[model samples]
Target chain A: DVKVTQSSRYLVKRTGEKVFLECVQDMDHENMFWYRQDPGLGLRLIYFSYDVKMKEKGDIPEGYSVSREKKERFSLILESASTNQTSMYLCASSGIRDGGYTFGSGTRLTVV
Target chain B: AQTVTQSQPEMSVQEAETVTLSCTYDTSENNYYLFWYKQPPSRQMILVIRQEAYKQQNATENRFSVNFQKAAKSFSLKISDSQLGDTAMYFCAFMKLISGYALNFGKGTSLLVTP
Candidate 1:
């Protein structure tokens, strides 16, 4: 079975603090994605990497950045955390076929 | 640009009954993919079913099936023999089969299964 693991399941941080959310996939998938989910808004893509050292901005990428130093790992970084950024963050990985994505359990973040 | 829409914000079904959730999308790409994902209280997103736009046949996974209307750009999910575990937030998503593209998701429909 394919596995996607997130570094943290729950996190709390103060405003203006820098935060990092890590994701690792064991499937050796070529594509990795980060999305923020909220009520009524669904999951909005923040950033995605098609390959190591390659990244693309999604619809809502402001205040967020991504890093992909290795094929199996992708990280989401919040330069300066704010209360409005508190939400559930999800990481996913996909292969070239059918666009099937295997997702992590998700990390619930709260910015105080 | 591609966009997915789920008209029903909430739905209910009694155990062992059948229920359909509506999803419509707009996309200019000829070849793409559509999917229905379930996010339970566990917060893990699981793929329920998927349909390829180029295929005329609808996709089904056991008790879960889809009604795909290519011309209408509509993709609806039908859950039969619903169980309590079927309760979750169902999201319809669209993805272009191209590089540098990500899944565009709908607002989601919250389903509640009652005995």
Candidate 2:
């Protein structure tokens, strides 16, 4: 079975503070993604990495950036955390084929 | 750009009953994939079922099955003999086969399976 693990399950940060959410996958998949889920809005992509050091902006990448220094790890960074950034963040990894995506448990971020 | 829509925001069913969740998507691409994902209160997203556009046969996994209509761009999930463990937020997602783009998701439907 594939396993995608997130660094934190819950986090709290003050306004203007920088936040980091980490994700690691054991499957060595080539594709990794970050998304924020909100009520009635579903899951919106924030950033994605297809390979090491290669990143692309998703639909809602503002105020957020991502890092993929290694194949197994992907990190999402918030330049300046705001209350509006508070939401459940999810990380997913998939293979080159149209295989199913494996997702982390998600981190519920609270920006006060 | 592709978009997914789940018109039903909430639904309920008694245990051991059957329930269907509707999903529709708009996409110009002919080759794509549709999926149903379940996120329980624990916040873990679990892939329930998937359908390939080229295939006419619906996909089934145990008690979970999909009603895929490629021409209509519709993918509905049906859960038979629903259990309390089936209660969760269900999301429908779409992905283009050629573009390698991210999965487009719907707003999701909150399901309650009462015992």
Candidate number with greatest DockQ = 1
- Please give the lDDT score at residue B114 for candidate 2: 96
Q: Which digits, one per residue and each the tens of the lDDT, describe model 2 over residues B34-64?
A: 8999999988899999888889999999999
- What TM-score would candidate 1 get against the native? 0.98
Candidate 1: misplaced stretches above 4 Å?
Answer: none
Best-performing candidate as measured by TM-score = 1
Clashes of each: 0, 0
Interface RMSD of each: 1.2, 1.5
Q: Per-residue lDDT for A1-112 in model 1, tens only?
A: 8799999999999999999999999998999999999999999999999999999999889999999999999999999999999999999999866488999999999999
Q: Per-residue alpha-carbon lDDT of model 2 for A1-112, expressed as tens digits? A: 7799999999999999989899999997889999999999999999988889999889999999999999999999999999999999999999887558999999999999
The model with the greatest lDDT is 1
Clashing pairs in 1: none
